[model samples]
Target: MEGDCLSCMKYLMFIFNFFIFLGGSFLLGVGVWVLLDPLGFREIVAANPLLFTGVYVVLASGGVLFLLGFLGCCGAIRENRLLLLSFFMLILFIFLAELAAAILAFLFREHLTREYFSRELKRHYQGHNSSDVFTSTWNAVMTTFDCCGVNGPEDFEDSLFRLLSPRTMVPEACCQSNGFPGDVSVEQCVSGSATFRRNKGCYSATVDYFETLLFSAGALLIVVLTIEIFAMVFAMCLFRGIQ
Candidate 1:
């Protein structure tokens, strides 16, 4: 009965590791895709330092998971104690790292407020249709969120774009309309007319979008951590049963 249980656990470990390998491959592929940026998605993420760091984090995680999965599979199949031990250590390290990251994120949460974002926006935003990455990214954000600047049209008052284009109060992206350039005329939008202007700032909409993504990611993190625990347990059990 013990032998049978050990055999079953070995197979379970193999299957679970195989799935983890596949997941790692998928993440690696996504990281590569973003890095290569054939679809222009990289431009959006590259605009933010945090988002850019997240890409590398994904790549690192995928590589670690790939290595772990390989070690687990080999250790289970060959009944190699060294490989199993390595896998266990790696998982534990990752678990601890995740806990630390979570703690740090919680502690720094206060720094990520709207005022902070608005200050950053004020420092960097050039204008609508500017060729710079920061301007382009902000344009994309304003357009996607249907919000203007970091805190409405006034935020652009002192912008380089406004300085250059004295007549235009806000970008065309700030127009409230059914289409890309907006159904309203540029003159109307620039005139600060309520019917044509997007009065709200991008902060609220940006927060909502990121909060949803973070919630989903947090849930996924929990699931991954749980799986790591099970994997460590199985690896340890199998290592002991090997003799």
Candidate 2:
């Protein structure tokens, strides 16, 4: 038992290192792929404009944090003197980059916001080109780039792609049976006239804002946790590489 326990402890030490690197890898992948919000289509832009923009910013920052944390963790597991030293320097640069971006976002957010609002209003009135309901889903796209301190980046493109992504919806039968607001409506004696508001694959301000808020919060969590996971994974990989 004593020998087994000792062996287990030794194994745990290595396992933990592997876990560290695993976490780092996972976070890195998620940071790159699982991102949404400013890049997603929740119709938050035309719906609540500024409110939705804030949510998108928060969600994006969360992903950035995960990426940072994972990088740091990967450096932690490095025993190679050169690798360790390089990571030390890299982490500092990453931190500075983040700080600079934060400052820029803070300063530019207000100036750009007024124009941003106007554009959103326009989109709202126009209703997102007949294809999208609540028509202004694209306004938040600009808002996101402004907040991110970039004019035209892949981030902007990704945001648009997310909008065109397929959406999940309840079946017409289910919606009608449960009296959900869907395409089909029934006219019953007690209910009189039931109308399912015509939604052209777009949500109104209330729906968009609420949905974006929830998704934004979810994205934040995923990013933050993913970073920690990356850190753990990176640590493990580093240790194993040396062994």
Candidate 3:
């Protein structure tokens, strides 16, 4: 009976590890998506150090999870107590680290506000004519998100507008309507009229973008953590049974 029970746990662990392997793959996919997402990923990366670090951290963790899941599968199938214990220890460390990160995020939640995004935007806002990568990225964000400046049109008042030769009110990207391709006149967009400018500010759009990312990542983390906890429990059971 004891031998039969141990045999049952061995297979149970194998099944559990398979699910863990799938979870690891999901993490890997999300990491790659964030790294390559064309819309606003680059903008976000250049804007905030904390978010930049978080992206790479998630990517690295996904890689680790992939390897650990393989290790777990092998350990469970072969009844290797050493491998199972090692897997358990690594997962425990990761779980604790995630918990710590969560606490830090909650404690510093105030820092993740629109003001923070505005500050970042203003800090990096180069002239519209600049060919720098950051400038281009910012333009792409503003154009794609259909937003202007950080707080509103006023945010750019201090940046590129100040550097303008004749002091245009807004950039072509911030215009409410795209001017005709053949028309080279700046009178339509740079006319210093409220009708030509975008009504929404980049600050709110930027906040929503990050909020969506956080929600997706948080959901994924919860799923992965739950899997890890279950995998740990099953591995422990198998290890004990084998011994």
Candidate 2 residue lDDT tens string, 155-225: 22223322442231211211123445542342231122224311222222333445665576456444534
Candidates in order, TM-scores: namely 0.78, 0.35, 0.83
In model 2, which runs have C-alpha deviations exceeding 4 angstroms? 1-78, 111-115, 123-243
lDDT score of model 3?
A: 0.75
Better of 2 and 3 by TM-score: 3
Each prediction's Cα lDDT score? 0.77, 0.39, 0.75
Please say which candidate is ahead in TM-score: 1 or 3.
3
Candidate of highest lDDT = 1
> In terms of lDDT, which candidate is stronger, 1 or 2?
1
Model 3 clash pairs are none
Clashes of each: 0, 25, 0
Most TM-score-accurate candidate? 3
- Evaluate candidate 1 by giving its C-alpha RMSD to the native, one decimal: 3.6
Put the candidates in lDDT order, highest first. 1, 3, 2
For candidate 1, the per-residue lDDT at 209 reads 61
